[model samples]
Target: MQIENMVAIVTGAASGLGEATARALAARGAKVAVLDFNEAGARIVASEIGGIAIKCDVASAEGAESAVATVSGELGAARILINCAGVAPARKMLGKQGVMPLDEFRRAIEINLVGTFNLLRLFADAASKLEPLETGERGVVVNTASVAGYEGQIGQTAYGASKAGVIGLTLPAARELAPLGIRVCTIAPGIFETPMLKGLPEAAQKSLGEMVPFPARLGRATEYASLALHIIANEMLNGETIRLDGAIRMAPK
Candidate 1:
């Protein structure tokens, strides 16, 4: 479907991949909603993109409901929902501290897996009631996963499991939402130049980038956003998890 004037909600839009997506959508004439837990950052992004910022914890029912309500009141029903609100905390199941805290694993699942489903469920329900566009598409949902989901390295038990759950969610979600004209897809990205990675030493970052089989560098946020736009434009592309990993199958650490 055409993005022009379409109401789109991008979670975790304060920075990184989500921020890039929000900007890209707005640049294409979509009315975007910048949703993030960082209210100030969200507001900054929203202001710059001419969108609205809503503080939301995508993992919580109340938070999701309130965010959806705010967006609906301000921007109309969202035709696109981008799930980029996730945490990537690397931890071993058994560390020097002993067995990993169960809460740590739960937190990862809550934000990365459950948060995605929560937002998608809310968005699908709203999109189903809307009139289909010229392409007979009511909405599109783009979820973010990670290469770690497939080749989980050492010290990534929690992070990898959460992302794998996201990968597992894609096809079933697409099948269930297809009849309602809502498409669902997931993007499993390799190491990117997000703030999280930028925090590392330059040598460490470069070493990580060199791990990619080709291009020998980190993936750019714009590249991910470009693929997302393509997915939104191409209706036939659904129920699939596209790996934006630069041919890099991660090695077990």
Candidate 2:
């Protein structure tokens, strides 16, 4: 779809991949809505991109609904919906501390998996109502997953399960939404320079980067954003989960 002057909504746009995508979309002349739980950070990014910032908890039914309504009312219905809001909680099901808290697992699933579906449903409903373009396309959705979902390492039970659910969601979502002229796709990224990773010591970060077979460096947020933009521009890519990892099939740590 042509991004120029089109409205786009990016969840978790306060930082990292979401922030990069929001900036990229704005640069391409799309009117973007930056939605994040971090109100201050969202405002900062939105201000810089000249897009509106909305404080939203993507996991909540009421919150997600309100956010979608607000974006539709203020920026018009968004043709591009990017699901980037998620959490990565590292914990073992059974460790020295005994069993992990059930809530912890639930939190990861809620934010990473359910939150994605919540937004997708609301966005597709609105976008499907919009007049189809010349190509019979009404909108596109890009979801984020992780390499860990496929090859989860030690202490990644919750995070892995949540992301795996997201991976499982792609093809079915696309198949169902196809008739509505909306396409769905997912990106499974390897280790990257996200804020969470940045918190690690420099040496630790380097060691992690070296795990990739080639390019031997962390994935960049801009690279993820680039692929997302391409997916939006490419009409034939649908119901697919493209791995943005640099040939890194993770080991069981």
Candidate 3:
């Protein structure tokens, strides 16, 4: 779909991948909305991109509905929905602490998996009602997953399960939404220079980067944004989970 002047909503647009995508969409002339739980960061990014910033929790039914409604009222119906809000909590089911608290696992799944579906349902409902474009497409959704979903390391019980759920959601969602002229796709990224990773010491970051077979560096937010833009432009690429990792099938730690 043509992005020019189209309404686009990006969750977790306060920083990292979502921030990059929001800026990219704005550069392409889309009316972008930066939806995030981080109000201050969202405001900063939205101000820079000339998009509206909305404080929203993607996991809450009321919050998601309100956010979608606000976006529609202010920016018109969103034709692009990018699901980038998630958490990566490293925890072992059993460790020195004995057993990991159940709430920890639930939090990861709630925020990473259920949160994605909450926004998706609301976005799809709104987008599906819009008139189809010349290509018979009404909207496109790009979801974020992680390489850990496929090859989770030692301390990723919660994070891995959450992301794996996202990976599992891709194809079925696309097939079901196909008739509505909306497409769903996912991106499973390897270790990247996200805010969370940036907190690590430079040497530790470098060691992690070297794990990739080639390129031997961390993924960039811009690279992820580039693929997302391409997916939006390329209608044939649906029901797919493209790995943004640089040939890195993670080893169990």
Write down the lDDT of every candidate, Cα atoms only.
0.96, 0.96, 0.95
Total backbone clashes of candidate 1, pairs 3 or more residues apart or in separate chains:
0
* TM-score on alpha carbons, each prediction: 0.99, 0.99, 0.99
lDDT tens digits, residue span 109-228, model 2:
999999999999999999989999998999999999999889999999999999999999999999999999999999999998999999999999999999999899999999999999
lDDT of 1 by residue, 1-253 (tens): 8899999999999999999999999999999999999999999999999999999999999999999999999999999999999999888888898999999999999999999999999999999999988889999999999999999999999999999999999999999999999999999999899998889999998998999988899999999999999999999999999999999998788
In candidate 3, which residue pairs clash?
A: none
Model 2 lDDT-worst window of ten: 83-92
Misplaced by over 4 Å in model 1 are: none
lDDT of 1 at 200: 96
Per-residue lDDT over 93-197 for candidate 3, one digit per residue giving the tens place of the 0 to 100 score = 999988999999999999999999999999999998999999999999999999989999998999999999999999999999999999999999999899989
> What would you estimate as the lDDT of candidate 3?
0.95
Off by over 4 Å in 2: none
